[model samples]
Target: MSINVFAGSRKALVASIALAAVLGSVTASSAVLAADALSTASTTVTLSAKINGFTNTDWLNGVWRAAPALSIPASTANNAAFKVGASVRLADGQVRKVTKVYVVGSNLSVFLDGAVVDGNKVGAPNVLSAVTIATATTSPTTSSPTTSSGSTTTVSSGIAYASGINNFTNTDWLNGVWRKSAGFSIPATSASKSAFIVGATVKLADGQLRKVKTVQVVGSNMSVFLDGAAVNGSVVGYPNKLTAVSGSTTETAITAPTQTTLATSGLNNFTNTDWLNGVWRKSAGFSIAATGANQAAFKLGNSVKLADGQVRKITAAYVSGSNMSVYLDGAVLDGNAVGYPKTITAISGTSTSTGTVTSPAPSAPVVSAPAESTAPADTTNGQPRLVGVNLSGAGFGPSVVPGVHGTNYTYPAESYYKKYADLGMKLVRLPFLWERIQPKLNTPLNATELARLKQSLDFAHKHGVKVILDLHNYYRYFGKLIGSSEVPISSFAGVWKQIVQEVVSHPAVEGYGLMNEPYSTNGLWPQAALAAAKAIRTLDSQRWIYVAGDRWSSAYHWPHYNTQLINDPWMRDRKNNLVFEAHMYVDKDFSGNYFDKAEVFDPMIGVNRVKPFVEWLKSNNLRGYIGEHGVPDFSPSAIVATDNLLAYLRQNCIPSTYWAAGPWWGEYALSLDVTSGKARPQLPVLQKHAKTANSCSSIGPL
Candidate 1:
């Protein structure tokens, strides 16, 4: 995948190929490309500033897109990367223009002006995506991350499975059924199960192994489930007309997977700086450090394999002049610390089912709620439903507050829910950390927390609002959930047990979020997490559970995990329960529209921003919501970002809540009127414009 890394004012649009060159043997830089066609012209812009982490390819990608505006419509040669003799020219010339950023077949070479530079590129093979410059040597830039609506995806899971399917069956019937059934009341029609003939896109829920696919029967009536728990029979966007049909399986092309070479960055430790970098090194621990011109490997873990039987554990490591001191778990591996790769030795891990990793697709991707587009049109629709927010009570703030402070805050817990309930709010999001409820492994929530939780549930019940208690944090880095007391990763099951035992009886607690942003660094989530979810099913059969996307909930990352739902994936209380959730926050390119300085006054550019994500949800047959979104109100720069955001919601018809409410976020508050002191100028915007959710009237497309 091509990444756009920006370096200062200049943005670099590099692919995962072209970044193997050295610039002054200095710190790695993020650079953007300037367009200069090889057709026979030259327009150059001098490198102004530089920043680390950008590849030359990043600049190439940016310049290509921004070309129309630069008024320099340079043509591209074959989709080649730094394949010698490529150049570009601007209206005025001074800088060299590079095109086609592709890494040179892993040898890691760069064409600077014209010469090959080596011993410069470093880092893990995939961790640092490279760039390809038209020529060997090109300056670099970076892709600034802006976090937009469509790109950043949050995949949420549900608990539902059909019965009696063989090992690894695509489960086509179920796939079509789920999509057709998504966002609607079920049993509305008597069409044969064959009606759900169309196949679906497989999507992975954050941290789960069993991939699930949702598809729809054109013109069939169904039930709607928001975040896994049924919301209402009348779905806002569900279509009500079924098209008469023949059923057939749709097939797609799958390209043969190709093997790629790995990078060997900092390798002074061993003459062969090959198979022992990053975690691959059996050392005590490791951390990424930047050096003046380069970086190298350091140790933090214990008993590592180094050159010549070097055995030791790391005690400490810090910069000493130009090089890094090594510390093994007991000793350190002395070598270049900058530009280090994990390990050159080919190490492998088993691919086990964590839940659903890849969703099976029998048909092409569909991003709209199912309808017989070929059948009829129903312009007449229904009213939208009332909306609410998930402040994720009993949750956390790794960004600012970390561990236990959420409980310490009284403003939102005691005050905000009451206000939202009184404000005619329809929902409130409450995310729970499994580790918090059951501090001890295999145990349940301690008495104090249980009692407090029950009281809050009772309070919400008293007010006219529904509660969505989601398990926000899961077993992760360092074993415990982020921002919570440290606990063993295995403690997840214990926490689940505690939750079902304590809250299963309460009617006020409407739904549950399985885990918050379960990011599978690459794609799939950890397996243990899915098993914990299954256990939760045995406890509360009727509860609506939410599964999310991995990689911090980026939707782009979800497609790889999408799969067809198998029969009886999980049967809780005999109810076909749950909904899928996806979060949004696209990469910088999609969100960069925020910088359109053209608007002296706040001008909206994201009118089309929500299109991509909303379309994705509709096509997947998953009932979804924008769980979290917000900006520091003080950043007037976001004035346009904010305006574009609201417009995005209106255009896509997706519901969302600001990142927080009440006073807990003293610095990042959208508004403090509810209490907790996080009040900002954007309070009313959330109240009136947050998540435009509603019950479906006649059915089809909200």
Candidate 2:
């Protein structure tokens, strides 16, 4: 089974691939344009222009536009000469692709893709030229070649055959052939047999056009010979071509939807209202309503036009008992408050389609997340302020389960406990592999691994830091899920029972994290968690138990998938000492990898993602803990977001640990570990939020 491990090795590989893909797609097209080299096509326009200024109304949505309107020729203005996908070359030698273009009167506004890196100097004092490519007049013909008994047939003058083909090797194209490489394989499916037939004009990554000369296929392997070797430019492989701009004879004015107050009571009392098609459309105005019946409309794949005028797709949504909370493409809408009715003047009809495309609309005003809630009003007196970092290294080399301790995976250094404790962090989340501790199912803990864990705990106690025993297994044992017949619930519970018996009396031990980011494919995590908690209580009744919900224990998804933990009687902890744990990341995909620079950072993203989980805890009267949360140090906005998130957690009287700190995490973006005798950039942010209190009196109940 391919489990999503929390180690940096896998994340680094993913980041590398993502970075390469981005570079391969955009590097070739983003070259500096040569003067007087514009395409001769009638649709392409080269104009001398000056950049007046810049505007960043909706930069997150790629709405950063050049300010002060530029004069547009009357003849070209009506032809949609500055439409999206047009190439723009500024006088300062910077080239950008047009994302949006607006025309009013004789003035033109051009929105460009990318962030405002150089301030006012970006496109200043220079003539701007735009090339609007027209759509193809004719489609590529599809003609299959006739095959003779033992001879291969060549196809000429037809569309490039790309059916059933996922991707191609970058180096193969340079060799005038498309052959299977070590990094890639040609599909063996019948549909792929016709792909890349000879004579098909295939466009290379650098926009160069070429034709196939010959083709061969043998089972799962295939090779296509091109007429000539393709040049491997800055863009290494196939390019994702830009959309063509179509001309419009008539000019259309884009206007913002007028706001009108609805007659209904809004979200104040959602249960008393009726929901239709996922929205409550009154005669006066429109309001999005959340209920069980129309819950599908507010789901992840759905889109919504918020009051701010931005059309955003829902990344996540949870509706329960007339209450609804949703994330607008990872940004929390209305602090993710349940039943916090989003009263808007207008709303698009509930769309089942996942695409976020919409007709051109006026730029939406920028809006930040709701102001951080004050802590004094909500936080109970004497609540524990547990702040710390996740001490890693012990859970490494998961692929080599039960591998040699020092050679494959080693425990974190005992000195890290004092280093973090001196930094005012008193709680340490120690992650170790379950397979290493208990090599066999339902067996006693491994003596060597158990001793190593005890030594780490002893060091933590010496530094007066509490430890949360984090079982860094994704609710799996040897690639099998907890509830699977291969790894039964009894075996999982038995392992926990043995672990508690060994460390229940340790002074440094704070709680038993039942499992790290449990992902139960068969919906068996809740049952498995309850069973483990019961077994732990039979031995140690006082130590708190941390139970993570399903789906990688994502904070934004808690209400959607973990409500059963509160509603189902069987899933409840018998001792009422369970503290629900969730993890949140501020990246676009919530994967903690910050490889894409185009994904604009929003400071409220951290608050937005964790609000649903915090609200869920408050509504259910349960204690909560953030087991994992961190941001890359390179992003200033991400650092600010982390500070805001930590403040929000402090205000709510909830404790959290930054992920993570260890000797082995060299140059890790989110690592708080000291490097070259200097603290990492993210360490000071953790220090600012770290608290000395170690008591859990403030947090209670499962």
What TM-score would every model get versus the actual structure?
A: 0.40, 0.46
lDDT of 1 by residue, 232-345 (tens): 112221232222111111110111011121212243332232113432122222323325422222322112233333222223333322333333222123233321443321
lDDT of 2 by residue, 1-702 (tens): 133344224333433333333334400111111111223234445655544443443221222321212323323632244554455655445455444444434445564543232334443444466655353435443233211111122323233344323254442232222331101123434544434433234533333333333333323444433322123322423333211111111111101122222222244333322223233211111224454433545443334544444444343333322444443421223312323344432232222222122222223211111111101101111234357888877876677789877655667776787788667776888889889999998778998899999899877755556788999888888988888889999998999889887765444577899988877557788778888988887765456788988888889988998876665663443335678999988877666766575566788889999999999987776778999998876778888888888877866657888887775564567777634446467777777777322222245321
Q: Check candidate 2 and list the clashing pairs.
A: none
- How large an RMSD does model 1 have? 31.4
**Candidate 1: Cα lDDT at 77:** 20
Q: What overall lDDT, based on C-alpha atoms, would model 2 receive against the true structure?
A: 0.53
